[model samples]
Target: MRKLKLQVQMTIDGFVAGPDGQLDWMWIPGERDESIFEKVIDLAESCDTILLGRKMTREFIDHWENVVDNLPDSPEQPLAQLMVNMRKIVFSHTQTAINGRNLEVENGDLTVAVQSLKNEPGRDIMVYGGANFASSLISLNLVDEYYIFRNPVAIGKGLTIFTEQKILKLDSSITYKNGKVIDKYLPV
Candidate 1:
């Protein structure tokens, strides 16, 4: 079966987003961090498909599409192209149709859909989630690998994906120059 990998950015206090979905806590001042983008490209290179949650689909797709269309000559072009070209499956009940190439909407059992994707012949699948989806996948124990980009700041109260306790074996960890840390973990 293909592995289902997940990448998420979270605060020091372990919240993925503020109560109002504010990401202001994650922004740093005057720091141009291209290394994180490089790391993202590295992870994307290993996966052929991207799985997304309903709430995350629009913003995520729009951002990458903007990068591909507007930043053709930028340093991020390679990663943008990869993101645009990769097959995307958004599991959404409310969003039945969205505009994009290589995109599909799935409103079925999450486990069944994910399992079927895992059984397919492919390199691996990458999942970008907005808290609830990540929580569900974590609760279901469907994630094989996790890449967490941890910011230095902490928000007192917010959304978190860890609905249940998980014992993780740390595979690797790195502290970026921008003060953001990346930790790769595998469930133990």
Candidate 2:
């Protein structure tokens, strides 16, 4: 069985994005710390599948594919290529069909679908989606590990992935030079 690891970036105030869905508080292009990207690479290398919600599937796939296609020499090429070629399962109620080579549509019971995936023999799976989707996974006790990257800044009011109270056992915590802290936690 493989673990389902959720990786997300959040503000110091526990918000994933601002109230208006603004992410300006995060590191800008020239200001981004390379450590963050490196950390993501480490996680990406450990995963062979990506779980996404209906809302984020298209944008996430297109962005990575475009970045790798246009910027052949991009610094993020390694992660981009893996993401582009990896198997992606989108949880959507309305979307009955998906159009892509490695894409799959899972409109069945979330728990059943996820459990079936977890029981498969493969590399770990990673979750990438909106707050609601993440919250759903957390609420259902489906996430095996959490990789939370907490930025330095705080947005007082915004979207948070933690809607229900969860007791987490910290597996590890590492802080980068850019004031970003990555905490690995397991459900207690």
Candidate 3:
């Protein structure tokens, strides 16, 4: 079976977003390093399909589509194209039917949907999260690998993906010059 990986940006204190789902803390004022962007592209190149919660689908699609349309000569262009061409599966309960290429809505059992996707022949599956969806996946123990990009700052109280305590073994850790950290972990 293909792996199910989680790629999330978080604060040092473990919050993924603020009380109002704000991400202002994550967008620090500074020039972004090319190496960090390259790491993102590397991850994108490794995955053929992306899994997302309904809450994140629209914004995610729009952002990447804009990247594909406007950032033709950027270092981010490869990731833009990869994101545009890759299959996207959105898990939702109420809303449905997003008309676009390589996009589908799955309103069935989360386990069944994820399992069937894993069973299919593919490189790997990646999840770009909104807090609740990531919490559910972590609670269900559905994630195979976690790629956590931790920023230097902390949000005292906010949304978190790991609602329940679970032990994970560190697979690797890479630190950027700007104090951003990427930690790869596997369930212990």
Overall lDDT per candidate, in order of appearance: 0.90, 0.88, 0.89
Ranking by TM-score: 3, 2, 1
The TM-score between candidate 2 and the true structure equals: 0.95
Error of 2 at 174 (Å): 0.6
Model 2: per-residue Cα lDDT at residue 123: 97
Tens digits of lDDT, candidate 1, 1-188: 89999999999899999997888877777765988888889999999999988887888889889999988788778988988999999888787888876899999999999999999998899987889998999999999999999998888999999977899999999998889999999988
What's the CA error at residue 125 for candidate 3, in Å?
A: 0.3
Whole-model alpha-carbon lDDT for candidate 1: 0.90
Global fold similarity of model 1 (TM-score) = 0.94
Report how far residue 15 has shifted in candidate 1, in Å.
0.8
Off by over 4 Å in 3: none
Instruction: Report the C-alpha lDDT of model 2 over 1-188, residue by residue, as the tens digit.
Output: 99999999889889988886677887655667877888898898898999998877777878888877899988879888888899999999999876754888899999999999999999999997678889999999999999998888877899889987899999999988777899999999
* RMSD (Å) per prediction: 1.4, 1.3, 1.3
Full candidate order by lDDT, most accurate first:
1, 3, 2
Worst 10 residues of 1 by lDDT: 23-32
Q: Model 2: which ten-residue window has the lowest total lDDT?
A: 26-35
Model 1 clash pairs are none
Per-candidate count of clashing residue pairs (backbone under 3 Å): 0, 0, 0
